[model samples]
Target chain A: MGDLTPEVQRIAGNLLSQGQVDLVLGWAKAPSNGQSVPACIRQAEQAGRLIFDQYCIHNLATGLLDHRDSSERIGIFVKGCDSRGIVRLAEDGQFPRERLYIVGICCPGMKDQAACDRAASGLFGETAGDSELAGKCRQCAHPNPVIYDELLGDQQPPFLNDVRFSDVQRIEAMGIGERGEFFSQIFSKCIRCYACRNICVACNCRQCIFDETRPQWVGRSTSAADNMMYHAFRAMHVAGRCVECGECERVCPAGLPLMLLNRKLIKDIDQLFGPYEAGLSLEEGARPPLSSYRVEDPDPFVR
Target chain B: MKSFAKSAITVVLDRLAEQTRTYVPMRDGVTSNFSPWSERRASDLALNSLNTTFSPKGIVFPQTERLYDFAVDGQRADISGTHAETGENILFGARACDRKAFAALDQVFLRRGYVDTNYKARRDGLTVIGRDCLQPGPFCFCDSMGVDPMGADGADVLLHETTEEFGWEPLTEKGQALTLRLNDLLTEKELIRPESAGCRLEVNVAGLPEKLRGMFDSPVWDELSTFCMNCGVCTYICPVCHCFDIQVMNNGSSGCRFRCWDSCMYPEYNLMAGGHNPREGKRDRFRNRFLHKLEFFQERYGSFGCSGCGRCLVTCPHSLNMVLVINRLGEVKVDAS
Candidate 1:
């Protein structure tokens, strides 16, 4: 905290003063309380309000969508996760990558609010400190942005965690009947609210296929089959493109183990196609394995 | 590229398991899918096996993922989203069909607007190790798409299964790095060329776009529509189909929004907010699926979207294979020839 506050101020002030950007999008302490929220500051004087800390978990990339068509270039402060979203948006050509200046910050794994609450209730007293972080932060693999124009903090090393497919392995160990029951139970809880789809950065579409009523592809009733269709179909759409950001699972109010569904797909994609990433670099001209036709592809189902 | 005795393939797999999670095709009950490799699991890791009941797209896209989470109190809202950790893993035994599917998905998700950051992160950290397919299955028509059964374009590390020995070739930097780590398990030897097999089906889709355009109003769709249940099993199982929808939800005072998968087979797929449905009928919807695959995706990305994985044939309740549909559609040859 020695020069953090001052450093943020300096960067924000300099960017504004030098006309590097018309607006600096960063986190500022809420005027009413200690909470930090996303702010779009235009003047150098507002730099004093900018803050950077654990509470600054909001993905600033969402704000960029609002400014996509704006003439004024924006300077955004991004955490590792937010930077990925920005990179994805840029890769998709949603906006010009050169238009914005990125201020990246390295992150250590953040806390999980719900997981901490359960752990505290069992062992420690009511006071558990600030053991709560965002759910996505808890399992974050890339706590540092891969691409950034101006990094504010010292670069952190890449995460080297062991591959843990324990949840999927456990499900695989269960009998077929048991596995069916498990998925049935989990899918049965789906209300078709589509909270997962909304939060997904990859899910930015002007008109979604689910909302298309002319085709009547899927029914409006939130029945068990319809919900399953919705979840499974949504997953397939983003298949080979989902980055496993964990935003969909965290937003689920019902606390569904949504990560398991994604993990299962990720595992399968790795097994089927060669290693491919969504937006790291745009070097290869080849399409994703699932979307392209190849004459010699293996298809044992064909007689 | 070095050829090792059939017995040595297991040795390489065992060594891979010591450091990374290794997956191989295995039968879980009646359905076949990729499962983790174990030393005593030789029977489970069936090489050159039948197509799994499910498409392999699950490796990257995932069924459920958190885009970001936001909560609003009064007028203020807080949001949080995170990216996956980066690490190397070996995709032990991928089939060529699924490998081709990755290319199609990449075009739709990665090539189109906003490279999916989440897919990029997970994909970059992965190394695809492919195995050759010796025999074509019932629905196999990858040959019609001009894909090589023993190709290594999509694979970082390719393992060619020969009659007497298995050959391993590293095609990318990631594969080379993985090979360096697995030096203890492998012996350095020259790469052995693989024998190529003839494909089951041969198709000239060069004129497919023009053919489809003329046939849009053809009665062939009536024939195709008779068997279609409109269940979307074909679109759901196809490795390259990428249509989706965005939705917003409110739970009391606070709510979140999402974009989920959407299919063209359903009648409600084209309905707007004011009850306006564009592709209202099954015939139009069916036509859209074909047109998008054979025309639109190709028109946009310079390639047809179908990877010829044939999962659609197995999953479809009526057993509708695109090859047959395309062939039947092509039967009424526009006489332009």
Candidate 2:
């Protein structure tokens, strides 16, 4: 139940009052009980609203993308997943790295919102049980933020295992028709709310293709065929830049397994090209695996 | 009024399903939606646990529906309505919120000047079998907006769920007609009226719709829209979010005009052909969404559009539901000196 909220407030207040940042973005208690939502604090007095806990599931760094060009620096609280979003933003040169003041919090895996709803009656402390944790957190490779301007609690060790990829392998093991049906069923559940796209830090575009109507790509209908095209195209768009944040799947109202496509691409990148982890740091080669490819890369189709 | 045991309730549904295509709450993977009942795909009669996800408004006002088809060229422009497979559909286990939404939709589609034949064709023979919600879900706030989770607003027949039995009260001609068919399945069980759980979250609905009339130019929209993702989840999940866009699917020689669900939250919803979008900012769009639900619909339909199903509470990525909006706006000093 203990979180470093006091510490977070102290740092954010210091940053905002001393003119270190114009805005301090973090999670705050939601209007409802046992829930938290992303908050944007512009004043030092409002800095008290900043919170860090198991309920801080949103990737705040995505919203920070719009504020990148501001004259004054912006302070952001980042988890392992959110910090990766920062790296992805930096890699694309979407924002100046100097403009950000990152306050990283070591995450002890988070729980699913639905599971949290189910457990709301328990009235208990943070429990790190596998069943309670989000699907992404269960197979997380990084519990500590890969990059941060300031670190909060004691760093937790990363649980490095590749069991998550077997999901992609399991799909790969399926016959083509079965795979088609599998994805069709998932995509059909899409309400086309664009929660996955809107919540994504990597899906930073001035105008999303789905929203464009001049030469409309995806029509405004929730048909299964149209939905399939929308997701398939988005997976290709965020292929390499995706930092395994799992925000897409988390934000999905229909509970469609969106990370399956993103992780499948990540798995392909690792196996086909080489082991590649996105958004580790700006110091690491900024280009995502697909953006800057070597000609010597192996190909099963080209042959 | 006659009550039947939990097991015998299936007998009633089975008899109904024998003739009419019964739309029952069935488990659909991670969520539950109304699916047609069959022998293999039985209904999830644990209606308390299984939510409609959104209300059953889609049954009347569908997500996307084709109006008619016209010629690609100007020649032979006879609008041909799609042939609908004619059959009666019964929405079983429909909640009061869902039934209220059906009535609200009826105002728009049936009672309106130009009755929408597309909606009318489907709604004419349709019937609602209502069930009382004992334990309301995390997001339910139906009672605040003049809706009872236990009341039968649009239902022909109302069923009260208890631990051991379901008390049936046939309300309309449809119910009495259907009851005649369930002659053998009927049982003489005691009608137990236990206390029902309704929406916990409260909003001040009195004089509020009128209050919203002058507050369109308010600053509260800015604060609310700051966290708004402009996603259609809220509108789609909403029971009475009935704004839909008219679009035409064009092939070279053939095309079909259809109506698809649109959100006032989207920028394109207000965009003009002449490149003018009045509600351009997220603030404007956000304000419009609640205003339409509270004020505009009240002006037109004599009631607020929202049924308080609370689908938006659980579904919104950010917890920006009507509860928060109502609370924030209610507290806002409209004439800040």
Candidate 3:
């Protein structure tokens, strides 16, 4: 990737100085431990803190949710995966497109900061050698931003040039009982921390079902049944709307393969509702397949 | 001192497993945490790891626990349930930082005239074996938090790891009994203890709690909580975060009251019955979390709530963590008026 730090700094500084944006959401090197982290700057003078690096893995688009209630205009830096999240939020009516000044980057597959920490700690038996492209970046179908007010860096090739549903296919090949056991094993480790839900830009529900108390939808217990319910519900809920950013899987402390469930739904949705990828377009009245309906849509369950 | 060769760790674990439910830090797939000892988990034993991804607090204060069961009958209520009970168990190979967190937990559950029966039951039956940190991890700051990396005050048995052997020093009756149980495996050898290294990370937490008492309305909180996504990652994975929420699982007329781990980061945690939430915003929740850790916990329990185990550092999806929060707090210029 090109050194877009100067460009990012200049854009953020200009946006803040010109009173175009109330906040500039970007990445900064954490002072305590040199790791790149999502940072926000209100003053143009603080624009020097903005950076773009391989370790800048967090999707800043999720940060937009924090300001949805306010009328504050935000200037945000977005990688390819993160840009989809902006579209996801905008399409869901969580954040208006007018409130955002999206600065898009043609992402050159970033590295996972959490994975690096885990590897350095040697707690997971992972050596430094195992560090590579973040799981989300590896599956990137859109390295170039699908929508942007201003684009930066050279356009890059998608990391996943081959079959996008290869991992999903492996799970589909499993016998019914095997598949059940496979998910059960993953769900068993879940502590129900909801990092996946919280980190996700697509999970922009004003009030999540899990957090509902009047008629508590999902059990708070971290039992296999409850965890399975949570994961399955979330997967189906974001079926067509998922940006395939892999933030859900990346943030899961239990190391659950959440993308498998997501990709499975993506594949099924594609098969059921063909050739559809979510958050790719900002066309007026565009909506996810599940969110919008037609008379000719698949009636597999109806029959 | 009773000593055991590094190669005989499985043998030692097997012996302990026969007598009690032993939880050893072991690698599980891509993460490591305390789990029950078994042949399958034996090969994955990770005693040398800085600290497990998940804390062993669940061993005593479980993530979700059944409080009681209730049934509604015509004009009558039937509440019949057993209090939590447990047999003797061993927490083997826990680090000093994690072991220290038990004290904070004990203060919450077993003090001030309101002893939790479930917590008491588990606390009474659990024996801790804390391992010394000869080499502290980059994120570890237990010393700055007033904990000795080499000294685990609350551990029954303290294990000192050297080049090829472990020096076991029993501090309590439980530790002595455990030492006696594994006498055949442990040889009476004097192993040279390695020099302890300090954590690369350090913060001056001196008078921090006292200082934080007057900074409730400070603008620093607004700046500090800016990028915090308000996720439960920090609280859930934290060794010392001990808040919980109670709920009921209803099936027809019968239900069981269960309490699960709750994060103050959630808005509903402080939501009022009258549809008024005192901590409704992310900033309010974030401020409360750090204040609770830095001020309220210290004022109430006479010790910092955080153990500086650094689980939050490694696990927080966003880079918001205790170290950053504390450092930011340190930089705040307070007013005396």
Question: What TM-score does chain B get in every candidate?
Answer: 0.87, 0.93, 0.97
> Candidate 1 at B232: error in angstroms?
1.7
Which has the better lDDT: candidate 1, or candidate 3? 3
Better of 1 and 2 by lDDT: 2
**How far in Å is the alpha carbon of A92 misplaced in model 1?**
50
- For all predicted structures, in order, the TM-scores are 0.52, 0.93, 0.97
Q: Kindly report which residue pairs in candidate 2 clash with one another.
A: none
Most accurate candidate by DockQ: 3
Candidate 3 regions exceeding 4 Å error are A125-131, B72-77
lDDT of 1 at A180: 77
Q: Candidate 1, what DockQ?
A: 0.02
Q: Identify the runs in model 1 with alpha carbons over 4 angstroms from their true place.
A: A1-303, B3-11, B17-19, B36-43, B83-87, B189-194, B247-259, B333-337
Real contacts retained, model 1: 0.02
Per model, how many backbone clashes are there?
92, 0, 0
In TM-score terms, candidate 3 sits at 0.97
Calculate candidate 3's fnat.
0.67
Name the regions of candidate 2 deviating beyond 4 angstroms.
A31-34, A118-131, A159-162, A283-285, A298-300, B43-45, B70-80, B83-86
RMSD over all Cα atoms, model 3: 1.6
